[model samples]
Target: MDKKKVSSWLESELKGYTLKSSQDDFVNFLIKQADKIDKEDHLLLKDLAIDWINSEQKDLTTWGMTIAVEYNIQEATPSIEKLLGKVKEGKLWTLYYLWYIDGFLKRIKEKKE
Candidate 1:
């Protein structure tokens, strides 16, 4: 995966902003691009998702959590938990993100059992 290319497309297509109407569309589009994901992509996504989660911007944070959730990046769970405690916005959508992540992970565990 070309990090630069993906970065460019993300910035250009979404303008680094998550509009309410297009939010689900972008997330769904990314989920459909399973062919593009690999080990390197996973690592890149983990890093980027964590960075976005750490950011103060709500939209960036949403994108971060969305990617984490869609890609099954449980690595970001700790950061999301931390954000929930460290930031004011954490009480909002952050709560749902954490819930979704925790639920998703639990389901994965259940399926494996």
Candidate 2:
């Protein structure tokens, strides 16, 4: 999986981040990296997603969902679904974030077809 390469790329890409716009490139790059890694590495990607979400960086949070979608990390699906339910129940204020995750989940499901 070349974890070192992924870590190095992420560290370099995330340096001096200023705005969400800058994250687009980073997100795409990470997706490509995930594609190259072994499927068994899904746990690593899942952990990365959780870390980004917990970091509270809005853009990174979106990127995490992107990773989950790209890799089909089923382990994250329950958490994302729960969060979506909370958002729908008005227990969370981040509507856009939840919506994005919900959309990602739908996309993943569609891809399985």
Candidate 3:
């Protein structure tokens, strides 16, 4: 994570990736990024998640939910149910995004303990 501008590149990718962009390219890339993040990176992802959860685009919303689940981002808590409803109403495959919503709340509850 220390390749100077490399983080920006990652941020750019995360920010700009679209569902049509290589078909699941963002999800595929996030699979690698999911565990490598530290506090600063988590914070960055949190900020991104805020907007992503609010996004109308299912791909962005799902990716935001993925980051929220992986990182336990509390800030995203408020939007979880609402975002789930939106994604569920979208294309069927986007329903795959709903998978992580289960763990997200469970982990948040655990964190409170």
Candidate 4:
């Protein structure tokens, strides 16, 4: 691999993405970034999946779950299911917010898809 070119390209294309001054620093940074991203991806996917399971007015939650699961977001299912139980117990505004965000996200997904 053209490490220098890849490094330069990454630095140019991604904000805050830069090769460290030292090789050890760069290796450590990459490891730390990968770990951080894994954690963040877990959390975001969890929220999105919960938003799906808690949804009402349509099977939007199911659709959301389908999408998340397709992308291997397993961590989200439990949270989503928990929130769904709460929403089903008559937490009105929670359902509304879920639906609203679902609509917004659906539009975004449609455009991307």
Q: Model 4, range 1-113, lDDT digits (tens) per residue?
A: 23344334333332364665785665455445334434545554445444545654344454444445445555554545454455556664456656644444454445445
Query: How far off is residue 11 in model 3, in Å?
Result: 7.1
TM-score between candidate 3 and the true structure: 0.51
lDDT of 3 by residue, 1-113 (tens): 44335445555666665664673676667756654554447665577766776765665666766777666687787787666666678843367767766566566556656
lDDT of model number 2: 0.63
RMSD of 2: 4.4
Q: Select the stronger candidate by TM-score from 2 and 4.
A: 2
| Clashes per model (N, Cα, C within 3 A) | 0, 0, 0, 2
* 12-85 per-residue lDDT for model 1 (tens digits): 55454455377577676555443254444777667776777777467666666666766667677777766655
- Candidate 3 least-lDDT 10 residues: 1-10
**TM-score leaderboard ranking:** 2, 1, 3, 4
Q: Positional deviation of 98 in candidate 2, in angstroms? A: 4.3
lDDT (CA) per prediction: 0.60, 0.63, 0.64, 0.47
Q: Is candidate 2 or candidate 3 better by TM-score?
A: 2
The prediction achieving the highest TM-score against the true structure is 2
| Stretch of 10 with least lDDT, candidate 2 | 11-20
TM-score of 4: 0.29
The weakest ten consecutive residues by lDDT in model 4 span: 6-15
RMSD (CA, Å), each prediction: 5.0, 4.4, 6.6, 14.6
Q: Candidate 1, clashing residue pairs? A: none
RMSD of 4: 14.6
